[model samples]
Target chain A: MTIKLHCFGESGNAYKVALALELAGLDWQPVFVDFFNGETRTEDWRARVNPMGEVPVLQDGDMTLTQSGAMLDHIARTTGKLDGDRSEILRWLFWDNHKFSTQIGMTRFLMNFLPEAKRPQPVIDFQLGRLKAAYGVLDAQLKGRDWLVGRDVTIADLSCCGYLYYPEPFGFDRADWPEIDRWLNNIQSLPGWKHPYDLMPRAAAA
Target chain B: MTIKLHCFGESGNAYKVALALELAGLDWQPVFVDFFNGETRTEDWRARVNPMGEVPVLQDGDMTLTQSGAMLDHIARTTGKLDGDRSEILRWLFWDNHKFSTQIGMTRFLMNFLPEAKRPQPVIDFQLGRLKAAYGVLDAQLKGRDWLVGRDVTIADLSCCGYLYYPEPFGFDRADWPEIDRWLNNIQSLPGWKHPYDLMPRAAAA
Candidate 1:
C-alpha cells in the first residue's frame, strides 16, 4: 500500500512531512484533518492514527509514524538520501530538530499565534533570548558552510528550513542572520522545495 | 585526527553526541566547555565551530556539525545504524529528536535546574501540556509495539531514551505514562543504554 499522511491544512509541521516526501520523490496521499473544527480531537480520529490528537501522522500500511523530525529522517533513509558521512549527517539532523527547530519554532509559534493579552512579556522575552542565542550559534556554524552537513543538501537543511525561513511570522528580523538567510535562500532555490510550497500556498505565506 | 566534540561536561545535549560516539563504537575526543565561565560566548569559539554558542559541536577532520538532532542523524548515517525500513526508521528518529526529546528534555531541564523563584509557571504549563499531549500520542502508538520504529532498537529509541527516562527531575510522574515507563525500563536494560549511564556517575546520581 502507498504511504498516507494525515495532517491539517496549512500546518507547518505537516508541511515538513509533505516536503520530505516530495524531496524523496515519493507519491503519497494527503488526508486533511480539520484543525479549525477540532477534527483531530475526535475519538475515532485519535484511535486509528494519533493518540496525541495532533496532525502530521504518516500511515504506511501497517506502520504508523508521528513527529515531523522522525518523518524527515524516515523519508531520507528510505529514499537513499541519508548517505554521505552517516555520522556527520545524523548529528546535524538531530541538532536541527532538537535545537534550532525546537527553540526557534516555539518562539515563532508563540509570538505569532498567542493573543497579545494572553501572551506574557517574560515568556516572549525568554523565547526571543533563546532564539537570538541560537541564531548567534547558527551564524557562527554557517560562517563558511553552505549546508548543515556535507557539501550536498541533506535533511539537516530541510529540517532547519521547516522553521527558520518563517521568521517573519514570529517577528524575528532575518537581517541579523546573514548565514542563515543565505542558507535559507539556497534551500528555497532547490527543485524539491518548491513542490510542496506550490501545493500549499498558505503555508509559505506564513 | 579523531573526532572532537566540544561541549559542557554535564549537558544532556552534549551527552547525546557522546552517546552516539560510544554507540557507533568510534574513537573521539571530548573538549569540555566551561558554561559558568561563559566560554561559549568567545568570538573565537563561535567563529570556528558553532554560532549558536552551544556545546556539543562535533568536528571531524574539516567538517564540524552542530545541533544534536543533526549530529545523531549524521552519526547514524555514517555508522550504518539507520537500518530497517529506511523511511520508517528516519521518521521515528526525527520524532524522537524533534518532539519527544525536545519537549520532554526542556520541560525536565527547567523544572529541575532552574531556581523555583525564577521558574515560569506558564512555560512549565505549556511544556507540560505539550508533553502530556505527546505522551498520549506515543503511548497509543507504542501499544503492543517493542520500539518506536522496527522490532529492533534504533536511533529513535536512543534519542527518546536520552530524555524520557528522567521524568522525575522535571516533576513528571511516570505513573501517568505506563507505556513510556515500560519502554524506558526496557531501554535501560540494554547494554548500550547502561554503558553511558554507568560511565557518567553524576548522571546516575541525578
Candidate 2:
C-alpha cells in the first residue's frame, strides 16, 4: 500500500517521517499543508484525521498514524528495518523520542520560531543549556559507536539526526559536539538524505 | 526471563513502563534508584546502562532498554497488548508520546519540581495553555470511545493515563476533565496498578 504523509512543508517533525520513509526505501506521497495559513487548525483538516491538529500524519491505505516517533517505529517494524537486538533498538528509539526529540528539538524550535522582541533572553539561555546538556549525553553515547544503536543506521538515528542538524539553520555552533557533527555529516551523505529537507527549503535557513 | 525496571518511585515515566507491563499481564521486577541521593547520576549507573542517566529503564534478562515510551511500545508489541487496526494503534501511540506525554507531562513536572522562585509564571502559563489545548484534543477524541484506540485498552491509554494521573501529587485540577478523570479511575482500579508504584512510593505521589 502507498503511504501518504500529511504535514507542513517546512517542519523538522515532518522531515523525520519523510527521512525514515526514504531510508526504508518506501514509496510515499507528500501532502503539504500550508502552516502560514493555519491549515493544521482547520476543523475539516483536523477532524477528518489527527484530532490533535498536528502535522506529519501518515496514512497507509486505510490506516492513519501521527507522532513522528511512533510513525517511524511502525515503519521500521513493518519494513524489517528495525535492526539490532530488539531491546537495544527500542532503547535508542525511546532515547530519540524522550530526550533528544523533546529537549533538543523543542529548544531549537523556541530559539528559531520566537520573534526577537518576544523571545526572552532567559528562555533562550535555559534552552541553550538544555541543548548542550542533551548533546553531551548524545555525544557520550556515540563515543566509539558508529551508530546510535546496533552497527547500522536505524530509525533512532533518523529521528535524532533530523533534529540535531537543525542548529545550523539557527546559526548555533556545532563545534563543541565533534561526534555529533560527524554523525550529522554521515546522515547528510546518505542516499535520499536531501529529499525531505529539499521539500522544506525553509528548514535550512541562513 | 523476568523483566526488571529501574526507576524512581514517583516518576510518571516509570509508571508508563509499569502500566504497559501490567496491561500486558507481564511479570516484572521494579528496582528503585534513590534520586534524593543522586543515585541516578553515578558513573557506575551510567556506565552499566542508560547513558542518558534517566529512569524507567527496562532490563529484560541481559538486554537493557531505557526511555519510557519506547519501553512501553516494546512491551506492548512483545505481549500483543496493542490491538485495533495497526495504523490506528500506531497513531494513538505516537499521540501519547509526542503530544500528550511531551506537552502535558512536562507542564506538570515544571509546576511540581521547579521551585516557585525559579519557575517562571509566563512559561508555566504557556505550558498550561498547551496542556489544556492538548487535553481538549484528547477529550474530544475520547468523547464516543471508551478507549483511546480500539475496543480494549492499549498502550496509548496507558501512556496518556500515566501522565494525566501524575499531576494528582502536585494538586493539578482534574475536575475540568471529566472523561479524563473517569478514565484515570478505571485504569487505577486495574490489577497490579499499585505494585510498581508501591515499590516506589515517593514516585507515585498520590
**Candidate 2: regions farther than 4 A off:** A82-84, A167-172, A201-206, B23-25, B81-86, B167-171, B195-199, B203-206
Q: Candidate 2 lDDT, tens digit per residue, B1-206?
A: 78888877667778878767766778887777776567778999888766677877889877677777667667776777754555566566566666567565556666766676877666667666666777777777877677887677777777777666542333246797777777777677776665435645463234
> Can you give the lDDT of residue B139 in candidate 2?
73
Indicate the TM-score of model 1: 0.76
Clashing residue pairs in candidate 2 (N, C-alpha, C atoms within 3 angstroms): B9-B203, B10-B203, B10-B204
Candidate 2 lDDT over A123-200, as tens digits, reads 556657656677788788787876887788887788777665553343246687888877877788877676455655
Which candidate ranks first by lDDT, i.e. highest?
A: 2
Worst 10 residues of 1 chain B by lDDT: B196-205
What does candidate 1's lDDT look like per residue over B3-73, in tens digits?
Answer: 88886535666676676777777788777676646677899878777766766688888787766766766
lDDT of 1 by residue, A80-166 (tens): 873456656566666666666767666765666656677656666767776776677667768799887778887767766676544
Model 2's TM-score against the true structure: 0.88
Q: Ten residues in a row with the worst lDDT in model 1 chain A?
A: A197-206
Q: Residue A42 CA error for candidate 1 (Å)? A: 1.9
Considering just chain B, what TM-score does every model have? Answer: 0.82, 0.86
lDDT of 1 at A89: 58
